[model samples]
Target: MLPEEGVNAVRVVVGLLVRGEYEELETLTEARRLTAAEIAAAVARHGRDLISPPDAAFREVDAVAVPHEPADEHAFHVEFPLWTAQDGLSDLTLGLTVTEVMDGVWTVELDGVHTA
Candidate 1:
């Protein structure tokens, strides 16, 4: 399971994506792993339509631990079920990776909007 901090970070990043706040989203992400342009393109290509609905909401589903080579680092693939009033449950899921930068601090990496 991802820590509460990680989950909260994911929530903020997803909110930014839904709002088309790419510049703000880029600031919360790791530039070494995901570039600004890639972030913008992925959100534009995959997240734009799915998250455009004003009533869309993301509910936490589950998180899977992702192995990392560094002993001090940790990662998890977190998933959230997307829902909107007009469409009910969406086919697309909001997913992202959260990495522990140091101790309890984590950074969000956008996986974009994808079907689970």
Candidate 2:
């Protein structure tokens, strides 16, 4: 998949997570690999580390693509420098793996969330 497409997919996934839209988020993930409940639990466990509100809007500040073997799988490390009215540029990043399942179709897997 193209880097731009991967970035766009990451943005959508992050947006859903921020907005607490886990059900929709599940649809974008790898088939049967992730569930809405799992996503909610992950957020509940680690959300405090984030500087942005649950409903805060975000943008992709930077992204790096890592090529994988077999030529169909790629990993993207994306940073969204989240901020708030009180704090500027909080360090939160997301790791996502994008796999091409078919000719032009892809699936995403949330590797993890990180803070710095």
Candidate 3:
């Protein structure tokens, strides 16, 4: 799997979570190639509503313009040219627990740990 593919998979997971489609998350996990970390990062970065307390946990990582490198047939890394958003994500230092991950699905548990 390519890095771009991984990024797309992250997007799917965010959509599923935002839409509250837990079943799609299950199906996406089987079809997409991504890591739980990537999905969690994506949700933290893109899923604005998912960004919870402490507020400083969210971060707009330099945009992922470059493709990701697949660790294997099932995993990949997020690469980028470092995008800067005008509104940039807030709380730029929170990490999430990967409760689940898949092509179009993802679930993360934010325990309020400050990555800063």
Candidate 4:
């Protein structure tokens, strides 16, 4: 099990993703090229249309805590169940890595994403 602080970090970052909090997301990412606003716009623009339907908004997200990831022992898996724009089922796992930037402050970064 992840420590309470680490779990909180993961939840906070994922919550930002769900809420489309671009400005805050910017600070959380390690991407050197794209800004958080750019990422947010992209997610909003293609979210449901490309992922769900012609114009279906990203209504909601359901996440499940999975076991520790084999690829990265330092990271953890959070599975998100979603339906495609074609109405087909697709699942995604967010491999998140949280680093202790300072005393009580932890920085969570998007390590990678697995889609199935």
Tens-digit lDDT string for candidate 2 (1-116): 24556555656776777677878877777435568887777656654533333433333335566675667655545555444333454555555666555555556777555565
Model 1 TM-score?
0.71
RMSD of 1: 3.6
The count of backbone overlaps in candidate 2 is 0
lDDT digits (tens) for residues 1-116 of candidate 3: 23344444445544455454545554555424434455445545543444222222113222222222342223323222111133243443332223213553433332221223
What's the C-alpha lDDT at position 63 in model 2?
Answer: 54
- Count residue pairs with overlapping backbones in model 1: 0
Backbone clash pairs for candidate 4 read 51-85, 52-85
The global Cα lDDT (0 to 1) of model 4 is 0.50
Residue pairs with backbone atoms closer than 3 Å in model 1 (clashes): none
lDDT score at residue 10, model 1, on the 0-100 scale: 72
Candidate 1's displacement at residue 77, Å, is 0.9
Task: Note the Cα lDDT for every prediction shown.
Answer: 0.67, 0.59, 0.36, 0.50
* Model 1 lDDT at residue 44: 58
With candidate 3 superimposed using the best TM-score fit, by how many Å does residue 52's alpha carbon deviate from the native? 13
Supply the TM-score for candidate 4: 0.50
* Local accuracy of candidate 4 as per-residue lDDT tens digits, 1-116: 44556656766665666565757776766653346766655555545422321222112223233444443334333344434454455454445556544456655656443454
